[model samples]
Target: MHFPTLATPFIFGATALAASLTQVSNYNNNAKAKPGMWVYKPDTVKSDALVIAIHSCQSSAQKYFANSKIPWHQGSDRKGYITVWPSSTTECWDVSSKASLSHDGGGDSNAIANMIKYAITTYKTDPKKVYVTGGSSGGDKDADELFGMMSNVLAATYPDLITAVSLYSGVPAGCFVSSSGASAAWNNTCSGGQSKASGEAWGNVVRNMYPGYTGSRPRMQFWHGSVDGTLSPNNYQETVKQWTNVFNVSTTPTSSKPDTPEKNYRTDDFGSNVEGIWAVGVGHSVPSHLDVSEAWFGL
Candidate 1:
């Protein structure tokens, strides 16, 4: 399916690219093929800082574009950042096989690598300021596929390409010990059970990978709804704990305010390095007041 272009309240560059499926000669022809679409928006004013990518679960790039309320509309637009969103081949990211690894050839990671090259070559995006964000399943998988296993590819492909990542309502991919692992991880305790093993495994990978990086650790931000039901908010909390412990960061107050009488919240920074937030009354869905696209691009 194609992303539809709609009229925007602000004047910015926007374009939609069609979804395509490519064949990998090395992989089995019998292997399942992944297809995805991409949308690109360039900053209005030239920007040295650019956020290159954002994604969400089971949704088209077009949906993200439509939902984003760019700051330009509010008359407080920052210098434009390049925004790119890629659709998943399926409702969930393929996180099971070696092909799913970010370093795998012709996988989702490769797609992202290609997109970044295109962005810099075509849009004149800054290499140092590229960022990424996502929610739920997409957010989780992206952590590993983009940053964990594919770190080499990312660094090699765009040496200065990635600056930070913001994940909302999701744990790192491969963290769950079982389908039910979310329950234990969120609670900040692990019990012997046959839940999703992915979260646990992914957690170990993050512990090992992030700290040893020769480059600066990318800034990380995590936000979760306190009352999240589909995926426990606790899972997100545990993930934050893991990040803080590994990065050796401490918490400090950033913002504390109410969304409503029933739904207020606060944000805190971990040693001014990482950000973690809990939205008290928010649900499994995206918060109503935040613009997904703008948040992704840091616009």
Candidate 2:
């Protein structure tokens, strides 16, 4: 595949991108907001929307931000966005840890929410443009926990703040059942393989996140390789179904191909809220066209 040119989003003011990159940490809540790498283009600003790029299992924030081989850093420095890469306390997101299953959620997931809080207050990030996404397990960490359980689980738990969410090679909530059980919410460890749930079943999971949800729910996107080995590619379909159901999107996609092609695409609107893209021949990796992923967020 060819490397993406990545010149889509209009460039912002110089103040935004003045610093090519910097390290910021929330000392007030140091435990929650891990020392994350902040990236900006040459002309970006504080009001620009933020992309919280989460890492895959056994990966670090530094690797995605500065890794020479991966183009993640390259597209990350494009024109219209500011990027944040926060490290996980454990090798993977706390998805498998027993503590992650807790009612208040494990440290890793809660910390990510805190990171979002820090970004909004400190960087003046656009709340409506804020997006959360990751590669592999990082994509949808808390989806496998339970149905309408109201656990303050992963970053998705704060849908009240996030405008949109996208996942790559990930599963939906309750996709896997934990071995430790409800009493041991602290344990992230799980015992089952992927537990398939229909779109309606998982939609109920998202609705349960907020005790009394009223406003617009987070928009959703799903991108995965047809040949993903780390996680089943079919899971993307389930994730799309869940998000679409949550947003009340059409059962069949509004549009598909070239614009949202069988490979390398951006799907038609799912009621102006949800979309899915597929990358053929790609594996358990981040979509090569980081620019397209950003565009999915309407950035």
Candidate 3:
């Protein structure tokens, strides 16, 4: 082979590097990995509406995508909406502290919050339409450690970023009343004790979490199975009361839908939209559709 006098090895090396980078992109494209928080978009196309759906304990973002967990799937793709399912550092969100919201910034909550920001920045998600939801452990605390549960702490932090949150079989904020966390201690006070929280106790918790002047707090939507064995039914009703007090809505639901595809549901008219879904005959799972949540979020 003959080389041109002007040919240079450095030029050839640069071309090789570019080709390698191109190969990596092609491989990822074929692999179908979505950007930010290990999310899954209907298409790598575009979306303004975003759903930050966290998986239950021992689950991953891939599982949410595989099972079509939230309503952001199906017809949502065409509507310019996308859903993100992020894996916790170790299957749990550290919502105990506001700083935990950013990924690698601190606990799981920090990272998850960072993920939402990523979706918003990367996909240009609408701040108003932004929403959050989780399954059994996803919504509540992980039994393993009473992990920094989402519903318990969301009201306390990130009020500006997250518009609303949906909880399925979730735990209330005060379950961890002590500085030191232990499963046995939490289980004794919280496990199966489904008493509605004291209006003062929980209301104060939310108010303290969002201590500042005035602005609309994030709305709340709760769903729990009446027949859930792992979680107390009392907890379900109590959850409703907690949010009611936080939102300053009447304890009773204004709109109650008694018959769905599988279970009965209802929603109270809180100024900022706080609703509860009592699944008459379901378990620790997503009893209704994500579209139902869209309606709840007023999207």
My TM-score estimates for the predictions, one after another, are: 0.62, 0.73, 0.72
Q: Looking at candidate 2, what is the lDDT of residue 110?
A: 54
The worst-scoring run of ten residues by lDDT in candidate 2 lies at 143-152
RMSD of every candidate to native, in Å, equals 9.3, 8.2, 10.9
Off by over 4 Å in 1: 1-37, 68-78, 102-106, 135-160, 176-203, 207-212, 250-263, 288-299
> What would the per-residue lDDT of candidate 3 be over residues 42-145, giving only the tens digit for each residue?
53345577776666555555655554434444534545467666655454444433333222334455555666766777767787778776644322233322
TM-score of 1: 0.62
| Per-residue C-alpha lDDT of model 1 across residues 1-299, encoded as one tens digit per residue | 23343444222333322222222222222223343535344325356554533444445555544444322212113444545555556554433333433332454555665666566665666776676655333223222222221222232223335666655565544343233422112212221112233334434555442233445555666666776655566555565555565456543334444443134656666665566667776656434233532453464
Best by TM-score: 2
Residue 136, candidate 2: Cα error in Å is: 7.6
Relative to the true structure, how large is the alpha-carbon lDDT of every model?
0.45, 0.55, 0.56
Per residue, candidate 2 scores C-alpha lDDT tens digits across 1-299 of 33333432324344444555555644245343243445443353423787777665445666555555434445555545667676654544554333343323534555666667777777677778877766433223323212111121342457776777665655564444356543223222212225557778877765664546667767776666666655566666777777788877776877665644433544645667877677666666434355655667666
Give the per-residue Cα lDDT of candidate 2 at 22. 58
